[model samples]
Target: MTIVNQLKISAVSIKGAKALEQNLLEKISKEKYKPHDLFLSLEKISNIYNVNKTTAQRALHSLVGKNYLYQIHGKGTFVAPPAVTFQVLVIADYETGTNNDFGSIFGIPAFLRGVLKKIDLEKYNYSPVMLTKKKFIEILPDIELIYRSCRGVIFFRNIDIFVKTLPVLKDKNIPSFFYGSDALLESVSNADCLVYNEGGITDLAINHLLKLSHKKISYLYIDESPTQKKRFNLFLQENKKYKFCTENDILYFKTIKELIHNNIIPDIKRLLKNGITAIICGQEEAGVYFLNKCLMAGIKIPGELSVLTISNYPICALTPVPLSAVHIPIEEDAGRCLELLIDIIEHGSKSEKHISKTTIVRRLST
Candidate 1:
């Protein structure tokens, strides 16, 4: 053979051997064979790949050099310790005990479920770290350890907590993204955010009520966060265009405990007396509470009061009168955020914001 042809053939063989080495490593990782049990004779690899013994030997030697496998003096080649996996950390404002109960939390569980479903298990692993408002300060010292271990982070929390904790991740140059409505604010400009359009959700709710010819409506909420504020503000903004409700019709409570202690039923009675026909609720729990209270007061749903919730959980359907709602696409948004995070990690791309659309799900309550 000509020298040029011989050189080209030799290069092809080397490339083939390298490819075989990668395939072997992937196989070892997938099978999870013990180091001693993974030892394979040169003949075994040759037969497995249908390559010559010299090619197998070259591939095995390359793996050994890269610490993917080890060779002993007399023993055959063995798999090395598994390579460290890329970890994506998820931080959210929730207690560990409430992790499994979607009703107790907001849409966080649904969002997390979507993220878990879409993550590439072969290339990356995820660790969910729940942090409550009370425990956030306690976890500050351990932030460095978390930052060092995780390649990226996905945050779903209030603006205050996010603003406080984000600096640690930023200091380490770790890629991160915010998932939820709190990320919509100008204060959250630093991180890439996947936000549900509060305006769109509010518009959907108000438009639905308007279509139903409900003129006197009210907006109700229990908590005051940036997200809640956005929803409430959007409700007000949309009300201006529709003229369905006024500022006096808005009802808010500091907490659920306060709502009960102050007797929310009495307020509902008063709202009904004032000719309020429909209510748009910011929190799902608040929607449930209002529905129950209205029912207990012998108020006929959709006949006397039409309730609509801006939430993600399907529990709304289980109520006495299945609630109509502006359903936020929590799972889809979560998956999109994870995809964006992976893109940034793999491609060194600039972080970008995404706004997920909301749709009104018509049901008995409306």
Candidate 2:
């Protein structure tokens, strides 16, 4: 699902899907789609080709991965001409799933859009290079070369990358901007960072759940980063004011996939038995899964178990019960951070630190 049309071409094994892809790619290659000419929508492609929506999607993705087409999430795909003369390098994890773009994650799209709006498109277009954390470090030297060439950079990923990349940017004098919470910056040094007030989620969590007098609140998360652990700990300390949660009322996982695959029936049964009236999830995916499991167990949401997550991913809207979330101003922060980097690159402005704003979005799950 790595749709780097400029870098890789994937083999499409499905006969019908590959044929559709070939048809579309051939037209695109023949310049049927002029520069910036929007490609057909999934529904339109499906109806015209007499194929399923999945086949149409795969076809479009094949072209994008082959660099024949490029997508702008809500905006339709378009034929790509010669590569843009890119000045800014945006680094993001290439989420390995079909239909995922830079905007697939919660905060990234907003941040990316905000940054894009401020970018001087005539002088500097952005080159987004998406790679997983492991992939980035595996090709660290190659990555550094790309960084050295860029006028500026926008980064969002693991601290390992931050630790390695910040120094390279510093040494090369390529201004860099980082996006994450303040907790992520604890171990890192001398990096210009944009920290969204992710810690405010705890305030949102406490206010919403406590207002309802939810006793025996449970917190669950994948402690993949310091912020996740910090958020869980912060919740614990804050809840101490009311003494709502205890030792057995919390659980965690190493990954979201593990949390999804592992049976949560026992956890649900035990928590309910222990008088757990509400639950706070550190991620939206976990909130969705919890709701699904609760439905299966004939449990009423908010009635039996109030659920809230710290994310505002689109899945919140898609879930049966729209998930309550804390909306951090990562998008706003990213735009400002990008402006900072751009100014440093063009005007030799000094790099500085800034924190993002945070707020709550309540839905039925709360």
Candidate 3:
């Protein structure tokens, strides 16, 4: 054979080996194939790849570390499906929860579920993964593992963790998105977000109270989130108009129990001290808690203090006050959030952040 022809033949042999390796990897990605099936008789893949049984064994061993396949003592080798997309991993966050309170933890998940229900799953088969408030830094390795399995992620109510891992996703060309209130507003340009319109919603709740002639308002809030802070701040800004209705002004509290523990019974003390007669809660859960506290303190509702909230908790009606509240459009917001996430994943648009508005729903106790 000519020297040049020999060189060409050698190159083809090397190329073929590499091609076989890639082909196996792709098969793993495409289906849940088992290594035992590939090595069913050892003679099978050998003929298929035109490689000796020893070379095939070496290739299979190399893929073991890559998580493409697994070995079973009695059964055989099994192939794992390619890691699912971002949505598949994040679905947990979209499931319904017991209550709608930040402190409840399930509130965010329930809201996400409401959103995911409206999304076209065929196009965006992603899931919402939950990360604890302080576990971001320690979770990088696991996050990286998921990255190898899936190409995208939908982070839920987790900013610090998302920020820490987002750069890695960008480096690996993995798409990352956020839903609900974003803790990393500046990094928002790098990630898509479906944020809640706390300002508009708080405005709606405050306006609802105003229509009820509730001038003496106090807001019982938990400052665990930036979103809640903005809601409280906006409520204060709108409280300026209450001066026109009566001298009873608005006040803020960190926690319902804290106010009581500090001997500062906001509803009762307000009535006796400042003549404050109405309350607007940051969330419906807190509204219920406050209403119960008021009743225990012998405070009359609507006759002494009207209670309203910014969130919708069905249990609010069971409260002694039968609290009134503005319903946050959680279901609609979820749909819009998933739609925006899909837009980011498919079209690569990272400039605009979608914010859904909150609407007021008047009920008793107003």
Candidate 4:
């Protein structure tokens, strides 16, 4: 095995074989020593580096162990084909409360649990990262290195980072998939995305309630997020479809305080007195808070006023009444993402992309 003109390298000979090792790594990663190309023989490296054959052999074996090069029984060493790494750059958005382990975070987020569960641990390494949007410009260089190093990326609910990093990823030829809601991501189109059909949640919930003989269904929620607004608009559309538009059927709360700590008894009694037989909550946490308030008021869920919710996470499932809800198929979406990513890594970005569907999980609350 031979590589010409790399006859001499000097980087603190005290670092010894380590410097020689770095030189070889630079050559391979830069594609100077390409796949199946013979690397410098141990004898040549030993002479060039002015190191013992044992030291050169150790350096060669280190690259072999890392799969950068391979040694045939009697044929010396040759560069191995660049292996597609299992490392995936998982990007997460952080608010006031969260954590990060260096570039990667430690604890898994609720949405990420399903993703991690469906990921092949033996073949894939999921790296969760949280970089603040405010610091985006400052961290651009570090972010670029991350994109270049990873074979693929899995981003959850971080549209800003996903959009900003797309160009760098394209420059590095890295494939990425961002899982989020349709409402929040409607404007972006260049990257692969798994969108929670926010409107579908409204359709599913409304259809379910209407089928159960619920004519006077009202919409209620705090935190008018994009997904919530989308859900509400869809609900209005559905109501229009059935010619059931009534201003009294919609209740909007300004904050979580209004749903939780603020007086809600009058609101509950008002709905019942007005023959509002059911309520569709825009957010699961809001629904849970409302449910607890109802229970405190001795109101029977489903029996008195059926409760339906749009579940972005597992908040509804943890309830005592098991609220009937329109759910994002979190695990299914994640599984599909994993499959799509594997296909992209193996067959290129032209590999067919598939998006998972929103679903309805019926329970006692409805």
Decide which is better by TM-score, 3 or 4.
4
Model 3 residue 54 CA deviation in Å: 38
Looking at model 4, residue 124 earns an lDDT score of 60
> What lDDT score belongs to each candidate, Candidate 1 first?
0.73, 0.71, 0.61, 0.70
How far is 115's C-alpha from truth in model 1 (Å)? 1.4
Residues 12-128 of candidate 4: C-alpha lDDT, one tens digit per residue = 333566777888799789988779988899889888778887668777888899899998988878999976545665566445344322111312354556666766556564443
RMSD of 2: 17.5
Off by over 4 Å in 3: 1-88, 91-102, 115-139, 142-147, 182-190, 221-241, 244-257, 260-267, 283-285
Residue-level error in angstroms, candidate 2, position 334: 3.0
Alpha-carbon error at 174 in model 1, in Å?
0.9
Alpha-carbon runs more than 4 Å astray in model 2: 1-86, 95-110, 120-149, 234-241
Per-residue accuracy of model 1 over 1-366 as CA lDDT, tens digit each: 999998987787798898988888788778767765656788988888888877788888888887778887877677777555666666665565365444436577777788887876665555444555556556556755654456677776455666766787677677778876643456867578887766667677877888899887788876743465566566667557656556676787887556545667777777788888998887656677677777877889989889988674787888888888878788888788788888887888887777887888888988
lDDT of 2: 0.71
Q: Rank the candidates by TM-score, best first.
A: 1, 4, 2, 3
lDDT of 1 at 147: 46
lDDT of 3: 0.61
Q: Runs in model 4 with CA error above 4 Å?
A: 1-69, 72-85, 94-108, 121-138, 144-148, 226-245, 351-353
lDDT of 3 by residue, 182-229 (tens): 434655564567776666666677677777776656666655434655
TM-score of 1: 0.73
Q: Please, what is the TM-score per model?
A: 0.73, 0.66, 0.63, 0.69
